[model samples]
Target: MSKPKVIVIGAGIMGLATAWQLAKKGANVTVLEQSAVPNPVGSSVDDHRLIRYPYGDKPGFVAMVRQAFGAWDEMWADLGERHYHESGTLVFGGPNTPRAKVQADVLATQGIDVEWLSPAQLVRDYPLLMLDDLDGGFRLPTGGTLRCGRIVAALYRHLTFQGMDIRPFTQVKDVDPVTASVTLADGSKLTADKIVIAAGAWLTKLLPDMASRVTPSRQIVIYVRPPAGTADAWRKMPCLLDIDGGNNGFYLVPPTPGTGLKIGDHIFSRQGDPSAERIVAKAEAQAILDKCAGRFRNHGDYRIIEGKACFYTVEPDEKLLIEARDKALILSPCSGHGFKFGSIVGTRAADVVMGAADAEQVRRWATGEAP
Candidate 1:
């Protein structure tokens, strides 16, 4: 029997990973991208993205994370290198910390190692933080960061080397889900046996019906240099999730190899034009700096290095949306914490395409409901 032909729209992490998996499974795969494979405009680009096992209240998500890690391990084996940094993550509670505390407690019930630290211990052990006003936090040893840009690039190279067609700079004008065909910007149509739309924030434009369920959210991540004396401490600092600032509280990714210290909040604007030029206004950027000033110790010593704007199609509950419609599967594997699970989501998509799993099962698996 001949291998099936597959068409994947958008070359983000999800698309690339899916393509890589299908190719490995002996499917003829072709990936389309509006930008380069490592397009900075897409949600997957950055110096680093945080990946961990502690998902505050969602044990289902935590369960799925285990599978995600395994998927990444498989990718590492195939790529002949690893793009992950195993830095432990520390999460502090804010006014909303009670909810996070509940999440941490649930994680403990699942046999995940969690170490609660007192104020004194926090100060003594992690002096780079200003934990004075916070209630308390815990350490989850399984979490860390991924070199996302490198991973995407590696997948592209791997897929291309495997004889999968990767079409960069090729914009997809329209897609016929029922027919499993794509109409390109140049008015050309390409048909395939299976179609997967992993188009991140651009999902709405391609499928107007998904506009309400999956919204394009404009998010920001800023990289900074630690205060003068705390450089070493910052470098060694594990990823931090400050739950104290309520919605404004941000997650911090420490500087690891090939990356810098990054700060971003889980808050989603749920508004933005992905095609518009990314312009970070002075006041908008300053607000983030000011927010960080209130959260971090020695804020004055930190120097603003870069501010980047990225987009993601977010579901209301922030779950991964992997729905098979007609002949296509629409994938939104990111809300804020999606990068860590990219490898698994991609593999799952391949499974769905190859009839190894159904769409509903993939959704349940993504939410940690299925084994």
Candidate 2:
């Protein structure tokens, strides 16, 4: 009997990871990308992304993170190199802020270790932060950072070496979810036993019905170089989420492994054309720069390295959409926080396609219904 033939759209982290998983289960896999592999326009093409156990108020996500970390460990073993940095995470807020405590409570339910710190302890432990007004926070050592772009590149090379067909610069014009086929821009057709659409921001273009639920949010993040005397402190810093601080709260990714410190807000703009130019406007860029001024110490001494504009398909509640539509699987596991779970999602999708798992269970897990 011939193996099942599978075709995956998009070469982002999710797409490549799905194709890799399918191929591992003896399926003939082919990945099609409209641009080169690791396209900068895709949401997964960033230098680094944060991975941690803190889920704020969403407790279901805490369980999902445990599974995600396990999946990444498997990927790291297969790739023959670890792309993860275990820098821990520090979430700070005032006593009125309940997110830090909520994360600790949820994580404790799973027997994970957590340390609660008072305002004085927080300042003493991480002196680089300006937390004079903050009350307290929690620390979880399980959190870390992922070198995202490097992982994608490694996946591409590994998949090709394993004999999976990867076709880049091939634009897909139309898709038939019922037939498990797609039409190329040049009027060519390709059909497969199963089709997986993991197209990131471009996912809505193929599935118009999801346009309302999954919106493309144009978000911006700036990279910066810490001041002369603070290099040592910044290098030893953990992933910081200032949920109870100024500018409505922002996430800070410290300069790990010689990478630049990155700063971005958690709020989604919920607007932007994924196909439009991604150039950061002067005013928009300045807003982010100004936000950093109040949050970081020696802000004026830090150099603004670069400003980036990227789009993510954000659902209203920010739960991932991983339902099967006809013969196609719509896998837009995105909402700014999806890249961390790329490997696990791929394994689940492949299991469903191969009849090893139930589609409903997968949907429930993706939506945080049945963790």
Candidate 3:
């Protein structure tokens, strides 16, 4: 029997990772990317993204994250570069908040090394956070940031070297699952034995019927240059998430070699179209700056050094939808927070496409499937 030919749409971390895994399994894989690989418009272009275990309240997401970290380690060893930072993560917030307590509770239940810190303790360890009237905080020693863009570029290069056909600037207009073929924007067609739709925000554009279930939202990231002379302090800080005081967002990185601190909010829930999404708005940028100024330690006169607006195809429940539809498999995790699981999700997506596993299996582990 001949190896199955797989066509994966999208070139972001998830799509590229899925293509790489399929190719490694001896499948004839072709990745179709609408824009250039590692396009800045996608959510994967940030300087750093959080890679942590223990997702608040979701044991399944926590397990997936643990597995993902392992995959990241292997990639780092293979690529001969340190793509992940082990600065750890701090989740601080009010005692009664659902996300805050869930994060602390899940870590404790899983035997994950996490220190629950009181306001005074938090101030002693990480003076950057304003802990006035705060309930509590937890620290994950293994949490940190990943160089997102570099990782995507590395995966693309590695897959290309493995003889996988990656077509850039190739927009997929339509897919005929029944016929096992895809129509390109240039009026060309490509046939495949299996197809996986890993398109980030544009997944609904191709499958309009799914628009209601998968709505893309506009998300923004801001680069804040630390106050002069205090750059070292900010650089040494670990990736942090301020879940206290009813705030739900997290900051995953500090200043790198030359890059300044990157910050953003995770409160984007409004529906948006990827094609029509705004790049950045003055009002939105100002709000983020104000929040950072109020919360960050030694708050500097921050300027919006650079702003990037991307799409997050969020599900109603914020859980991923990895299911089979007719002859096509849909592998998308729309939670505004799915980029961190790119490599591991990609491997599981390949398993689904090759019939080695099913969607239920992926969901089982992601939702809390035990070993």
Q: Best-fitting candidate, measured by TM-score? A: 2
How high is the lDDT of residue 229 in model 2? Answer: 84
Q: Candidate 1 or 3, higher lDDT?
A: 1
Specify the highest-lDDT model's number: 2
Candidate 1: give the clashing pairs. 56-103, 94-243, 94-244
Model 2 regions more than 4 Å off: 94-96, 245-247
- Candidate 1, residue 86: the lDDT equals 88
User: What lDDT is reached at residue 102 by model 1?
Assistant: 86
Cα lDDT for residue 266, model 3?
Answer: 68
Model 1 TM-score on a 0 to 1 scale: 0.96
TM-score of each: 0.96, 0.96, 0.92
Report the poorest 10 consecutive residues by lDDT, candidate 3.
Answer: 243-252
Better of 1 and 2 by TM-score: 2
What is the Cα-based TM-score of model 2?
Answer: 0.96
User: How high is the lDDT of residue 130 in model 1?
Assistant: 67
Better of 2 and 3 by lDDT: 2
